[model samples]
Target: MQVLTINGQRRELDVDPDMPLLWAIRDVLELTGTKFGCGQALCGACTVMVDGMPARSCQTSVGDAAGKPIVTIEGVDGKVAQAVQAAWIKLDVPQCGYCQSGQIISAVGLLSQNRKPNDDEIDAAMSGNLCRCATYHRIRGAIHEAARMLEA
Candidate 1:
């Protein structure tokens, strides 16, 4: 059994100790917003926040995540993800939209630390997320727009 603080709620999950935190979130908790892109962490599809820092959940152990505060896309709200979501909607950033959750989470992580990021910074921060739609430019644009909205 593991006790996790998720979306500001304490959730106790009776799961395998070795199961990936992504599985625990998706299987046990039924929080499907956090996706599984590549199990090896090569893709950032399973991104989530561990104590406000973006983490690749596919590579994270459930036991290791036990007792840690976790936040998923479904948990996202308020001023934190609002601007990003708004920017995303306003910019029509998603094509296929499969990678948007991870991209958004990564953007949130980047924006949390650096409000103003250059193209290189955006590239560096959003490097891991693989979008088959090839919407990198739009994603970058949404990040910038989100930053501007947050600043306003």
Candidate 2:
């Protein structure tokens, strides 16, 4: 059995250690917020936080995630998360809304470390995440707005 802290809750899972964390999170735990975009980890749809750092759940092995605190979109909290969610809402960042959860997860991770990120930094931080709806402009704008909200 592999033990993990998910969304601030302790869980004991009986699954293959080599199984992808995305499956474990979505299938086992039934937390459907984290998505699977590309099984190869090329996309950020499965993005989650391990120890407050952005990690691609599709590529992250369940064994590798053991002992680390994992935070998914459903578990996002605190000021940074609130600010990001507010900014996303204000900017209407999502079109189809399929990638919004992962995007929001990445944004929360970015804002947690860097209160204010420049355009380059924002681009770099968000590079791995792709929006099929082509909401890049709104995503960038939301990040800046989230930063400003954090500052206030």
Candidate 3:
């Protein structure tokens, strides 16, 4: 039995230590918001917060994450996350939506570090997350909007 704090809840999951945190989140805990894009972590679809920093769930092992707090898209909260969500909705950032959750997670991470990010900063921060629908423009706009909303 392995106990991990996920989304502010202590969850005891009976699983292998080598299992990816993505599997623990989706298969075990049933939180499917974080996606599986590239298992190699090249794509940011499996992004989540581990100890308040963005981490690729696909590459993170359950054992390594045992004592840290993990926050999935389903459990994202606070002003920065809320602002990002609202901006995502207001800007209509999703096309197919498969990558939105990860995009949102990455956005939250970026805004948490720098409340105001320029286009270059946004590009640098969001470069890992890929949207097959190619909504990069809208995503950038949403990030900017989220930043403004955070300031307000």
Candidate 4:
């Protein structure tokens, strides 16, 4: 058994230490917001915030995630998160919406560190996240809007 601080709550999970954090979050914890895409950590669909930094849950082991603060789409809060969500809504950034949660989490992670990110930075930060609907343009727009909202 390992204790994980998830969404500001302590969760005790009895699973293999080598189990991917994504499974622990989705299968064990039933927090399905973190998706499973490509499963090799190449796709950003399984992104989650571990200790306030975006991490690929599919590649992260539960043991490595132990004792760290894990935040999923359900647990995202605060000014940055709120701004990102608001901007996402305002810009209509989702097409199929399957990957939006991971996209949102990645956006929040980027915005948390750099409030104002240029297009290059946004692209670099979001490069790992792949949207099947090809909503990259809107995603970029939303991130910029989120930064603007943060400025306000």
Q: Report every candidate's CA lDDT.
A: 0.89, 0.94, 0.95, 0.94
lDDT of 1 by residue, 27-141 (tens): 8889998888889988899999888888999999988888788889988776858999999999999988888888999999999899999999999999999999999999999
Q: How do all models score by TM-score?
A: 0.96, 0.99, 0.97, 0.98
List the candidate 3 regions with Cα displacement exceeding 4 Å: none
For candidate 3, write residues 1-152 as lDDT tens digits: 88899999999999998899999999999999999998999989999999988899999999999989999999999999999999999999998999998999999999999999999999999998999999999999999999999889
Lowest lDDT 10-mer window, candidate 3?
48-57
Candidate 1: stretches off by over 4 Å: none
Q: By lDDT, is 1 or 3 better? A: 3
In candidate 4, how many clashes are counted?
0
Q: What is the C-alpha RMSD of each candidate to the true structure, in Å?
A: 0.9, 0.5, 0.8, 0.6
Against the hidden true structure, what lDDT does model 1 obtain?
Answer: 0.89
Better of 1 and 3 by TM-score: 3
Question: 52-136 in candidate 4: lDDT tens per residue?
Answer: 8999999999999999999999999999999999999999889789898899999999999999999999999999999999989
